[model samples]
Target: MTTLPAVSQHNPWTTLGAEVRYENNWIRVVENDVINPAGNPGIYGVVHFKGVAIGVLPIDAEGCVHLVGQYRYSLEAYSWEMPEGGGSPSVSPVEEAKRELREETGLLARQWRELLRIHTSNSICDEHGVIYIAWDMDQTESEPEDTEDLIIIRMPFARVVDLVLDGAITDAMTVAAVLKAQLLAERGQLPEDVAKLMLGR
Candidate 1:
């Protein structure tokens, strides 16, 4: 038997004052004077994002997945993962996922399923993320943004999952989407055709 944890509907921390510390095109940093849940007075700094983060896992009919490789400026390292980008909150998440997939990998998907909604870093950042599983795609020419220098590759979906399990794929969105997709396929939770495609039946 599983016990459900009690959920709190009321907020515990009280905000006294808030000041913007920094602002940029993509983010705004704020410092808030607050009373902690333990009744202590303190300050909390948070990074607010300007847009919603989106990620797409495009699995082709051949049971292969497409990935985008790029050098992450913040981490100062090269990384390979599913196509991802930021999109305006005003637009639909699935629409943004489609744009990112086509822009980064030149793949247009006809089937789309929402996989997960996550906060990238809740303790300090309010960056919201949406991940999706996409299939039934057609290839086209990529149209990357001016700031992006990306490399695209395709490999077996199972091999991509192995990469995730082996610690080769560390991007949070990619890891979460891949593992959830695998579990869903194995448990028959996904659509029949999609499951068969994912499981390579």
Candidate 2:
């Protein structure tokens, strides 16, 4: 097994100050002052996080993967994304995933399995994203948030993989979740019960 580097020995810099440079609904930036181990003063950047995030790769009854299209103000355009959301202090990431799926696309899953947890942009942000695989999804009326406008879309599993290979699905968490699901499918690690609920099964 490959051993990972220790976090304590990774960055030997002492943070001096952190000032909020920008604030918005999607993200917030903080400018930081730091002193290096060599006794040199330096600056760093950080993002203060309010919650953890979750992304769900839902495989419907026909073995198709469900996605959502929404206008991301930060990107200034509409982009395809897996169902995702941030966890509040009062709720866990798993719960957040369920809520996000329903709110964004009005889909409900009869089965959910955690795939992985990823650290998104560890160099700057402190947010962690949990990835989940949802099977046996059923569609319903969407209930988007007050500020959200979303469109639901479903496509074959093969098409999703192609999109990832072609750089169409660029979101890190979504890509990770889909890849993990694919690997699990190949390895036959998915439980028979869950497999039976999958679209392709």
Cα lDDT tens digits, model 1, 1-201, are 599999998999999999999999999999999999999999999999999999998999888999899999999999998999999999999999999999988899999999999898899999999999999999999999998999899998899999999999999889999999999999998888888877889
lDDT, residue 127, model 2:
90
Residue 178 deviation, candidate 1, in Å?
A: 0.3
lDDT of model 2 at position 44? 86
Off by over 4 Å in 1: 1-3
* Candidate 2 runs further than 4 Å off: 1-11, 22-28, 37-39, 193-201
Q: Write the per-residue lDDT of candidate 2 for residues 1-201, one digit (tens) a residue.
A: 599876765767899998999988757899989997898999988896777887888887777778888788978977788888777756877788899888888888888888998998898898988888888777898788887777788898878888988999888888887777777776788877555444255
- How high is each candidate's TM-score? 0.95, 0.86
What do the candidate models score in CA lDDT, each in turn? 0.93, 0.82
